[model samples]
Target: MTVVIETRDLGKTYRETVALADVTLSLEKDTIYGLLGRNGAGKSTLMSIITAQNFASTGEVRVFGEDPYENAAVLGRMCFVRESQKYPDDFKPGQAFAAARMFFPNWDQDLADDLVKAFLLPMNRRIKKLSRGQLSAVGVIIGLAARAEITFFDEPYLGLDAVARQIFYDRLLEDYAEHPRTIVLSSHLIDEVANLLEHVIVLDQGRVLIDASADDLRGRAVTVVGDASAVSGFTSGREVLHTESLGRVTSATVLGTIDAAERDRLTAAGLDIAPVSLQQLVVRLTQKEEVR
Candidate 1:
């Protein structure tokens, strides 16, 4: 796959507060990447720097092998849908769509029209008067319809109900399949978008915590549940991410792969092995004091 975005030792700081620290990664063409972490984890900051919306304090960012800062050619190929996108006070949803149509070269008006109906967004209503969900629908519609070579969705599901959120996800996947493009989705609802991600990049405390394929990450940890004493004994030498106990029963989530032989050993010890979901794994990994 061709590399669409690359960052080398990227660092961003606001006064004494560090937003991103020595972050280095590459995003490939036609791939769906999940930019995941807790609030204030620098997910948005990194995206902002890559999209040239903000300046980096140190290091470099390359979008399509060129600096994105003030570069119209590179910037035009990328679309960023911010969580709280502001529009003109008098502009309506239709006007917003019109502006987006002129900006994004690949913008699809037909798809935008379909999304407006699906999201039940009022075209003529002033954007400021629209409900929070409706406002988010406007951004989702633009993000999906823009079809830029590389698109970034920064918390695009905010204020959207479960049903509406599902619609966004469905439409995004459908359009992506028909027209493959590089997409970076920053979302707090990890499990909700886990299936859509081909690659996963996790940030914690302004640093890269995890960067790996979704498949590899899925098997990076396992939960052992059984009698407290047995579970403790089995997980004694392993890296325990999290642990829970209910009277004599305990569940310990540990890092590392469990082979067939190890599984047999665990079962013989009367311990139940459970697979950890992506959400659980990320939460546990980020909660750790030292993940490096």
Candidate 2:
């Protein structure tokens, strides 16, 4: 796969605090990536630097094999839509769409028009006066309508109802099917978008915790439940993310897959093996970072 964005030894600092530290990752072309991490894990700061909205303290970033800062050719092909995006107080939804139309060469007015209706966005309401849902709709509409090559949506569904969020997802998938572009979605609503991700990148404490294919990530961890002593013995010397015991029964989430022999051992020990979801694995991974 072609690498659309590459960062090498990236680091960002603000005074005495490190926001991003020695991070290196690549985003492949024409793929959907779920950027997952807890708050203050440097997800936002990483996005800011990738979009060239902020400078990194160390290392470098290349978008399309060139710097993104003040590079119009690269900047015009990418759009970063934030959850708390601000516009001119007097501007309306139509004005926002018009500005995006002028900015993105691939902007589709027809699609923008259709999305405005689908989102039920008021054309004349001042952006400052719109409700939170409406504001989110504005961002979603722009992010979708712009049709940029690399689009970054930073929690773009905030304040949107379930139905509206679904609309955004549906529209995104439909459009992406027609025009495959690289998309990075940073969201806390993991399960909701789990199926849409082709790849997953997890950040913890300003570091890259995990970066791999979503399918591989799903099989990286498994939960074993059985007698406490047996389960503990089975998981001994392995990476355990979480463990719980209810009387004689014990359930443990362990990092690493079970092979043929291990599976036989688990079965002989009467332990039940359960698959772990992407969301559950991420929670355990980040939560496990708390005490370290």
The number of the candidate with the highest TM-score is 1
Error of 1 at 271 (Å): 1.2
lDDT of each: 0.94, 0.94
* Tens digits of lDDT, candidate 2, 180-217: 99999999999999999999999998999999999999
lDDT of 1 at 171: 96
- Candidate 2 has an lDDT of 0.94
Off by over 4 Å in 2: 260-268
- In model 1, the clashing pairs are none
- TM values, all candidates: 0.97, 0.96
Put down candidate 1 lDDT per residue, 163-224, tens digits, no spaces.
99999999999999999999999998989999999999999989999999999999999999
